[model samples]
Target: MRGIVLNATLAAVKFAGGVFGNTYALIADGAESLIDILSSLLVWAGFRVAARPPDANHPFGHGKAEPLAALAVAVFIFAIAGWIAWSAIREILTPHQGPHWATLPLLAGVVAVKLWFSRRMTRASEEAGSTGLQVEALHHYSDAITSAAAFVGIGIAVWGGPGYETADDWAALLACAVILFNGVLMFNRALADVMDTAVSPEFESEVRTVALGVPGVAALDKCRVRKSGLSHLVDIQVRVDGELSVRAGHDIAHAVKDALLASAPHAISDVSVHIEPIK
Candidate 1:
């Protein structure tokens, strides 16, 4: 919420400054900030939906909404990158007067804010285990880089040699490439979550250790883990004595689940344990 508000305000400031100062780089940076606002909104909405409990229609809960929103953010970033690149090319072909001197200081301020925001967001994302926030933090880092480029663009336009009127355009073009690269990375990460990639090796090991500690009659067979937003669901198979009664096996399964939930580091949504006869 705070991020959305701050980015929106910055977007307005940069766009207005760009028009008055005749700086294409500032305009492009402002457009990126506008998209940043949109991305933050999508992330907030995704988390809200993800936190909802399981419903009759969706048994696994709405946790997938997080990755879906992350994908949306990546798309927005791609669109902005393409637009910036196209505009930069046009500015390069038809040279224009350098930016007004006032735009330089304004863009410098933007770069500073983005740098601070990037660090703050990175910490928050790590603590929350939020993929969307992680992507947004990287986006902010990219924004800081591009805003620095914008600052240089304005500086070149206002103070460079007579033939360097297009320096700002070159900077904008570089910013566009950075945005595109970051967008692709963020997209791949979000897509992996959507595809139900396996949990981290450490998390899996932790679960296995907890499962083994439970008082069971035999060996463990298989373990599978799937992520659903901030939480995960687990499925395991265990082998017990062939002569054990069904109720006894059922009780053992519940005990394994309890032990795992009590010891696992992450929030586990559910656990399914399958009992097999010890061969």
Candidate 2:
């Protein structure tokens, strides 16, 4: 909720300031900020649904909804990028006169705001252990970079001699390119999450190490991992002593779960162990 509020407030300020200052680069940056606002709202909605306990309709709870929201955000970002690109292309073909000197201060102010917001949001995301928030923080960081580029371009247009009037247009074009690149990145991440791709190689190795450490476990046959918001859902098949009692097998599973949680608390949320008697 706090993330959503910050996103909304920053987006509104950037949009209004961008238009008033007549900085296309600034406007594009503002549009990117608006994307963050929309993405944050989508995440907030997903968290609401995901927080609910498992029900008959969803035996695994609604955790997957968060990834679905991420996918939606990716699609929206692509759409915004397309719009920005189209507008920028038009501007390049038929350039407009530069705005008043007042745009310089507005651009500087935006740069400062973006720097502060990105830093604060990144820390909050890490503390919350929210993948959604972390991804949004990355978006904010990108916005700050693009905003800086825009600020520089605005400065050049204001100070550079007569031939440099189109610097703002070129900057806007560059900003659009940055936005498109980010859109592609977000789309791929969303697709991978929805497809249940393997967790990072490091995370997979840690899971195997922990599972193999179980007392009676002879070997690990298979390990699968998926992320749910900030948590991980892990599934593993392990070979254990055939003579062990049911209770013993259960204890082994518990041990594996405990080890994983201790090593990477935010990485493993739920664990499922498949006990296979050693052959």
Candidate 3:
């Protein structure tokens, strides 16, 4: 919600400045911000859906929606990059008046705001362990980069007089490359989450330690942890004394599950335990 509002405000401001200031780069920036509003809304919806409890048709719940939302945001970034690049190229080919000096101050303010917001979002994403939030943070960072580039370009155009009007367009084009690079990296990360990538070894190690501490657990075999939205799902195999009764083995498995759910680094949504009796 905050992101959506901020983007809308920035978009409107940039659009006005771009038109009045005769800056195509500012207009391109405005277009990206406008699209950011839509992407932010999409992320909000994805989170709402992901928070839903398990239903009849979907046993694993709707956690996948989180990464799917991140993927969608990546797509939006790609689109805006292409659009900005094309617009910048067109503006370069056709000469125009240099951007107004006043526009530089506006862009400077935007860069500062975006940088602060990006930092804030980065911390939040890290704390929450949310891939979707991470991508959103990346979006803000890219915005800041582009705005800073525009600031420099506009500065050059303002100082260099008639000959440097096209510098602004070149800066926008450079920003497009950065945007595309970020898009690819984020897209790959989100896709990995969707594909059930394994969680970090350190996390799995913590899981093992906790499970081993449980009473009646002799040893552990295979232990696997995969990311699912804001949480993780674990599948583990345990080796027990052959002499233990079936009920005891079952109780141990339950204990392990409980320990993992309560003590794992990130929330463990589900656990699958297979018991092996060893003489």
Off by over 4 Å in 2: 2-12, 15-20, 258-265
Better of 1 and 2 by TM-score: 1
| TM per candidate | 0.95, 0.86, 0.98
Ranking by lDDT: 3, 1, 2
| Clashing residue pairs, backbone N/CA/C < 3 A, model 3 | none
Model 2 pairs whose backbones collide: none
lDDT of 3 by residue, 86-173 (tens): 9899999997889999999899899999989889989988988888889999999999899888988988999999899999999999
Candidate 2 local lDDT, 1-279, one digit each (tens): 665666577667767766887667667766777777778898778767766767899876777777677678778767776776677677767757764467777767767776787788779767865555555665676677677777777788878846666677777667767766876776677667668777889889888998888788799999998877667788999989999999998998888877778878765767888899989
Q: So what's the TM-score on candidate 1? A: 0.95
Evaluated against the true structure, the overall lDDT of model 3 is: 0.90
* Residue 262 displacement in candidate 3 (angstroms): 1.0
Top TM-score model:
3
For candidate 1, the 10 contiguous residues with the lowest summed lDDT are 260-269
- What are the RMSD figures for all models against the true structure? 1.5, 2.6, 1.1
User: What are the per-residue Cα lDDT tens digits for candidate 1 across 62-138?
Assistant: 98999899999999989988998898999999957878888888888888898899889989888878788888888
Off by over 4 Å in 3: none
- The local lDDT score (0 to 100) that residue 148 gets in candidate 1 is 88
